[model samples]
Structures are given as structure tokens and as C-alpha cells.
Target: MLIDTHCHLDDPTLLASLPEILAAARGAGVVKYIVPGVAPEGWDGIARLAEEWDGVCPAFGLHPMFAGLYDEILLTRLRSFAGRAVAIGEIGLDYLAEVPRERQQAAFRGQLRLAVEAGLPVMIHCRRAFQDLLAILREEHVQRVGGVMHAFSGSPEVARECIGLGLYISVAGTVTYRNAVRPLEVVREIPLEHLLLETDAPDMTPEPHRGRGNEPAFLVEIARKVAETKGVTVEEVTAATTRNAVRLFRLS
Candidate 1:
């Protein structure tokens, strides 16, 4: 079965029809989904969803895009949530956004520390700031509980570096876009064992579904693209990615 390693099910659009969305996903062969909390306000919802749904798991952190809302107390609160979460995530740098780089870095570092302290894997959200993120990981000596780089859009060289650092490269629905050469190339280069699939649902919908709200059910298209890119059977792609996710998240 397929596993969507990163998605925001708490998004209002999806949360309003979660049962329908999840049923569609199951019908499409999606057996599991990892929902990441994007800010302090979303943490409880994500955690509760994880508790209520056997197929849904949670990751908590402050997204760089939402860094401005963070405070020192949020870190403590995140620590407490980590006890019930599958990972600390949707956390990392995003230089492309208007948020100041320093503030983003500070928030990323704080959450990274919390992830380290809690011994939880991370679900990193990086955008136009791989080098800086890598540097922080190195400086912090972050060797334990490595995690996935969600919607990875880096070069093969960067993919290698992240893999060397004990991280998985998660390919999103973007790979299915006709013009997304780079993400497709990354998929071709990264080993299946180090690869995971995500929809980042409610966004990043694959081709044929672009401009529409993405959902976990569409992960089948992502898997189909990965299979074609790697010249493997769809079942093989599903099995490998699912195993990789289970290993990365320590999910049962």
C-alpha cells in the first residue's frame, strides 16, 4: 500500500471532509498518511487526528512561513507534544518567503533542539535554504532520529548530502508535473530505499489535478510517476516507499 509521508490534513478544507478524503485515499490504495503540524495552533488538532485515526500519524513544529507566530514558550509546548507525536516537523528554513532569515533560523534551531531532546525524527520543510539548513544540522551535531526532507527539490548532490546525514528525500506531487524536470531528476537519482512519497495535500496536486485541492488519495499518481521514473513496477514503488516511511518514523 502507499503511504503519504507528509500532508496537512488539519487544513480547513480537508478537515471539513476528513472522512470522505480518507475513504477516497483508502480506496486508492493509500494505507497511511503522516500529517504535519504547521504552527503552534495546529498542534492539538494534528495530535488528536493521530489519536483518532489508525492510519494518520502526527509531526509537530513551527513552519518557517509561520515563524513570526512563535515564542519561546512554544518550544516547551512542542516538547510536551513530542511525547505523542511521530516526529517534529514541517520545520526548517524558507529563504524565498518574506520572513527574515535570522528569525527563521532561530525558530528552526529551537525546534531542532526540541526534536533532539525528545529523540523524535524530524519532517523538515526546506525551501531555497539547503546550505544554511545543512550547516545548522552539522553545527548542532544532529545525528540522532534523522527525518525526511518533505517535498525535496534539491539537486542529486544535495540529496546525497542529506542521505549521508541520515535523512530521507520525500518526493511530492510536484514530480508529476510535466515541466518539473528537477524534481523528476531527483527522483531518478535518489535510491528507492532513501525515498518517500508525499502529497503535501491541499497543495502540490499532481498534473491532471493541478489547481484543485490535493488529497491523500492522489498519492497514487505520485507513486505512478516514481515507478515510471525509476522503471519499476507500481507495486514495487509502493512497497519500497511504505517500508522507507515505516523505518523513518518507527511506525508499527
Candidate 2:
């Protein structure tokens, strides 16, 4: 079975048709999902979904892209929610976001500290900010609790560094794209044990379904691509990645 380590099932598009979507995913052999919070307001709904569904796990945090929405009170609220969450993220720095570097850093650091204190793994999102993200993670000693780099879009060298830090590198639908040169390289270079798969649902749609909203069912496409890149059977890819996700998220 496959576990999509990152997917925004809380997003309105997916949430609206959750039963049908989840059934389709199960048919595709994608048995579990990790739903992450991008904003404080969304945390309650994500928590609700995890409680209501069998294979849905919840993670809470503010996305770097939503840095402007973070505040001290939200951190307090996040702490209260942490005990019920599988991880404290989809959090990290995104240089491409229009938000100031300082603001993003503030939110990232705050969440990292919370993760450490809460003893929960993290689900990080990074874009064009690996240097800063690596530095902050090191300073925070994130290796203590460990985590996964959501939709990792980094170099092979960076992938190695993240694994060194005790983090799994999650590959997304982009790995299936014909132009996914870097993702192909990363998958080839990284060991299967350090890898996970995701769809980033309602976005990052894979080939033959690139224009449609992505969902957990499409994770099979990513698994197939990773298997092709690593020269392994698709079952091997799914088993290894599912094991990796269960370890990171402490799935039952």
C-alpha cells in the first residue's frame, strides 16, 4: 500500500468530495494520507477530518506563504492542538513568497521550537530557500524529533544533507513530468529508505492528469515514476515509502 505523506484534503475542492476521492484512492492502493495545515483557521477542519476518517492523519502549522497571518496567539493555539497532531507543519521558509524573509523566519522558527517541545515530527515546505531552511533547522536541532521535507524540490546534494539531518525527502507529482530532471536525479541518488511520496492534492498534478486537480489516487503515478527512476519495482517503491511515512508520522 502507498501512503501519501502530504496532501491538502482540507482544501475545499477535495473536502467537498472527500468520500468519493478517498474511495478512489483506496482503489488505487493508496491507503493513507497526511493532511497538513496551511493556516490557523484551517487547523480545526483538518483536525476534524482526521477524527472523522480512518486513514487520514492531521498535522498543524502555518505555511510560510501565509506568514502574514501568524501571531503569538496562534502559536498558543497551535500548542494546544499539537498533542492531537501527527506533526507540526507544513511549515518552513519560502523565498519565492512575497512575504519578507524576517516574517517567514519568525513563523518558521516559532513552529520549529513548538515541534521540539511537543515532541512531534515536522512536515516542512521549502522553495528557493534551502540555505536558510537548513541553517534554521540545524540551529533548532530538528534532528531531535525528525521530519519530512514536503514536495522536496532540491538538489541531490541537498537531499543527502536533509537525510543526514534525519529527515525524509518527499517526492511529488512533479517527478512524473517529462521535464522533471532534478526530481529524477534526486530519486536516483537518494536511497529508498530516505524517500516518501505525495500528490499535494488539488495541485502538482501528475502526467496524463496534469490539468486536473491532484488527489491521493494520483500518488500511484508518482510511485511508478520513482520506481522507474530508481530502477526498482513499483511495489518496492510503495512498500519502502509507506514504511518511511509510518516511521516519520508514527502512523498506527
> Model 1 over residues 1-252: C-alpha lDDT tens digits?
888999899999999999999999999989888999888888888888988987999888899999987778888888888888889888999999888999999998888888888889889988899999999987765668799889998999999999988899999988898788899889998889999999999999998798889999999999999999999999999889999999888988
Compose the digit string of candidate 2's lDDT tens values, residues 133-152. 99999999999999999999
Summing lDDT over every window of 10 consecutive residues in candidate 1, give the lowest-scoring window: 137-146
- The top-ranked prediction according to lDDT is 2
Q: List the global CA lDDT of all models.
A: 0.90, 0.94
RMSD after Cα superposition, model 2: 0.7
TM-score of 1: 0.97
Provide the TM-score for each candidate, comma-separated.
0.97, 0.99
How many steric clashes between backbone atoms does each model show? 0, 0
Q: Where in model 1 is the C-alpha error above 4 Å?
A: none
Which one is best on TM-score?
A: 2
